[model samples]
Target: MIKDEIFFKNREVAAYRLLDVLPIQQMKLEDWIVISSSFGGYSIAKIIADTLDAKLDIMFSDKIVAPSNDECDIAIVTEQEEVLIHEELVKCFDISLDYIYEQSKKNYENNILSLINDFRHGNPLENIKYKNVLIVDEGINTGLTMMACIKTAISLGAKSVSVATPILPSASVQTIESIADDLYYVEKLDHFIGIDFYYDTLEEIEFEDIKKINKGLN
Candidate 1:
């Protein structure tokens, strides 16, 4: 039922469309630290941060996969290695939290940390304390990463949290609204598909791109 029609001609266009609805003009962008969900999530944050002249950071969070099922995400892991189990799902699927922790610890120690160093240039997370943080992604599929990012920011003493995306499911948007100070989006889709389905040309944002983006912050 979810057929793709070029809504805004990819992430750039989608970012602009979403921005028009956001109360960005009312805010001083310099007061925010725009946090990208990394790679695919960086597209929208780049435009918004550059237009508003805000500092940008990339989050290195990802999901913990269930054994033998790459698409079956059982838990969430943040940049700092905090693990959050999808409790209901874990119970329903008859999986143990211990297994989830093992997978998450492995993911954090192996994959996510390297990405954080490569994307954030080692310890770029220090300056975020007491700042307002905005988490940006092209779309929200499960909303777990955004949740983890929000919790991480709060733990790091971010005064407030906001989330911006071009597309999100209604349930995810509602969840985000409850937790974040603001939730901005252009579309709320049902029968939610992956973020890549919305675009015509989605490219991988490499370490060099992240470095270039971070360099602009200086």
Candidate 2:
């Protein structure tokens, strides 16, 4: 990490900063639905959703880590059973497709399902069909998880899928922009150590706090 290179005080500050750069005036805010990628992201997404007076929801996904290195994510699996693989990374690692699929199934059944049940009360996601969708995360590192959310939203019949994040690595911009209808971000860094590195306090959202947040969402 760069010496003392904190960008914002916390996710709330980041979300507010992001709102400054977002193209809000031109968008039909009423037609939009915001979906957060994780509980941590829901904090920022909720602010954006509330500010825009749009509906808010969360998307659940779990990373499929490399067999050799648990910290290395080879792909991501969404609660809806959608898998987004880093094909080149998998090939370079010589990871078997079978292994990836097997891991994805486990991630969905075990991890993703638990999150869905906890945050969403075991109910289905709010209807987003034909609605413009905005996917938000506090920050993005590899963009794999955000990509999974984008793809999942489209598959659920979203009219268009846009993405927003406070911080994003320069390398991921093109790849993410190619799939998303529009992308909004606060800072684009040449090198991002991790999402947590950019913020002073990007702490995990407690389960109890998450339940409270969910209760107020549409």
Candidate 3:
């Protein structure tokens, strides 16, 4: 939020650069479990999980956008039902805390609950405990969701936590670094546009695709 960061022609350009920071042979695949934030993250996570042939899971997070500015994010709610507040932004924008909490609850009920059952396809989340967990997303604009995911992973007993993504805003990098054991990104910009800005094809991914992708792995 300090300043508008980097811009790319497209997401592929960002992903190509992300290659250097990706966790390849550095960690054992057997000891890793790949989990992703729903919707925006599925494609990136799908590729990573399939390539590594690692067990995959999904976690849902919904952001509370500013009342006036749709592009502005005020906070994030995780599937574990934890809420992360962007204190500075909220204060600067004079967003009501009560409103944030209400939205968080609504998002959890309408989004996260069914996502948990659908993503897991009936399996329990026992594999993440004591494992090197990698949380995937296409990019980090506000960084709130990633932070919540990192914290949730730790609470679930993740021994180490890492993040893999194509892009991250410069403002969010330090915040995410404080929480993630290892943070990886293809590009770090001073600011980022909407998630759709980086892609050519933005599709509404069906939940069934998540089940099919992780099938037989867990």
Candidate 4:
């Protein structure tokens, strides 16, 4: 049973804890890249990337929600046009592939592309071909976003893909393990109460702050 208590005081605290388990010592640093799953993740990713001495980037991606339920994410899509649908959810709802594709295209062009332009000035993602990738997020809820990031990284020739997060739903552990090369997390809860519940000071990162972080990295 998972404990009923806050796991991290803040995202920075979680980042430091994750560094304890990440295999940074074995990595050459130059051969690895750190990618954030969201703008909020940049703070967490910055800490990890600084520790690993690796380049940091953001995965321009978004989730495709079901038509009837906005909370139900049916699939994930990246700016690179990579997609990963939740087959079980789609089947359970009898959702059509045509709808998924349509949503995927819309998400790519509308959401992901906007993020790429805002954060990266519309430049293509850094060359990660043959490089080990470590994807960081403050937390994972459905895991669809992270899964899509893994797929996109692999499709772009990432030699190996790993993930790091502060907390995740216990149910998602096995699925994430099967796809990524490694998973580093502080807590895996049997009953997830939402990512913010586990942190004492989880604030939404501002757009300007994220751009500042990007500039500092460059």
Candidate 5:
């Protein structure tokens, strides 16, 4: 078990260290696209985009069921949440919840693939080139999703693809290294229990909240 004090301390150190190593670029707002989900990753992406004076484009898997074919310069995705909160609502009255998890998982995977295809096809925000795309997630575990994002970016003719995650499992780092041109991670723990294990305030993002945020952004 990871000690809370030690974990947060290390995370703080890691965050600053990563910022130092991968300094935010002083680029125009038009040059960057921030694609993120409903949770912490979204918050982080927003901050990073602000630091770089880049345009922020928030994308949620739940809101935009289909991938975007718009032109964008950079794309960041908050790793989709694993826990299905909708299951709780169904189970409140003792509804069968077994299939919900499976279906949600399938939807998540499909959405990811679709987004990749959209990027590959040069469909990003209008006026944005969609080349030199960067994929940002909160954390990486197996690196499967990161690899998928990279492949999609490459197919879309992105000049380079970089991955930035706040934390990553050591094994996952190796897997990401094979495909990504550059990688920025805050922490490299050998026995990563879960991404939430490092954060002090981890909470579930409701689908309704996601919808509201997307609507606001639009």
Candidate 6:
């Protein structure tokens, strides 16, 4: 267990630490859209958005039975919401469950390609232009999901895709670097277990609340 003092004192440090690791050049906060799923990720994204003076978009995967890709400059999500994103992809793409299961068996490296191909065939939006896209998550363990997120953004026509996280496992960071144009991580714990270990307040956000936040932003 993390010591209380270490954890509490680190909160403020962790808050601003994200900005230091992020490749600010690729992130024109004013022009990008930020999406977050988990409470931890959303909280951090909110801070980052405020710091960058960018628009924030929030979505609860539980309520979104279908994949609703909105018009935004960037997309950010938490690790837990990845499964929901995949589910939405399945429904939006009209792919068979058998195909999804089979494709999921492959390494995460290829899983990203699957999501992009699925998006291409499923939702074909017009006049979508995202010069820079960034996906923010609380932490990354395998990096596969991040890759998939990056793949989806690039497939949607983002010129450059980047990732930001509060904390990430070293191995996962390496994997993300391979696919992302830029990567930012606040902490690289040697024995990282999960994102929850680093946060004091990890709450569950409701879909209505997310919708409300989105509405206010618009």
User: Could you tell me every candidate's TM-score relative to the true structure?
Assistant: 0.89, 0.93, 0.79, 0.93, 0.58, 0.60
20 in model 6: Cα distance from truth in Å? 3.5
Q: Write the per-residue lDDT of candidate 1 for residues 1-218, one digit (tens) a residue.
A: 23445465677888899788778776563488888876677868888887767887787777888777788888899887777677777888888878888888888889888876665556746468878888899888888878888888888888888888888888797778887888888888876667777767677777667676567455
> Which residue pairs in candidate 4 collide?
none
Q: Write the per-residue lDDT of candidate 5 for residues 44-88, one digit (tens) a residue.
A: 555565566555543334321112222311222322333323233
List model 3 lDDT by residue over 8-107, tens digit each.
4443454445555775766654578888866657656766766677777777778888989988889999877788899999999999999999999998
Candidate with the larger TM-score of 2 and 6: 2
Worst 10 residues of 1 by lDDT: 1-10
Model 1 TM-score is 0.89
Shift in Å, residue 161, candidate 5: 0.7
The true-versus-predicted C-alpha distance at residue 151 of model 6, in Å, is 0.9
Model 5 stretches astray by more than 4 angstroms = 1-18, 26-30, 37-40, 58-130, 207-218
**Candidate 6: clashing pairs of residues:** none
Candidate 5 has a TM-score of: 0.58
Clashing pairs in model 1, backbone N/Cα/C closer than 3 A? none
If the candidates were sorted by their TM-score against the true structure, best first, what order would they fall in? 2, 4, 1, 3, 6, 5
The global Cα lDDT (0 to 1) of model 4 is: 0.87
Off by over 4 Å in 3: 1-20, 65-72, 93-96, 121-126, 200-218
lDDT of each: 0.78, 0.87, 0.75, 0.87, 0.51, 0.53
Model 2 Cα lDDT, one tens digit per residue, 150-213? 9999999999999999988999999999999999998899967888888888888866777787
Model 5 residue 164 distance off true place after TM-score fit, in angstroms = 0.7
**Stretches > 4 Å off in candidate 6:** 4-14, 23-30, 37-40, 58-128
Cα displacement (angstroms), candidate 4, residue 13, comes to: 0.8
**What RMSD value applies to candidate 6?**
10.3
What candidate 4 gets wrong by more than 4 Å, as runs, is 1-4, 28-30
Candidate number that wins on lDDT, 1 or 5: 1
lDDT of 4 by residue, 1-218 (tens): 24548888888899999888777788753588899988778899999888878899888777888999998999988879998999999999999999999999988887778877877788999889998999999999888888888889989999999999989999989999998999999889998878888888898887787888777675
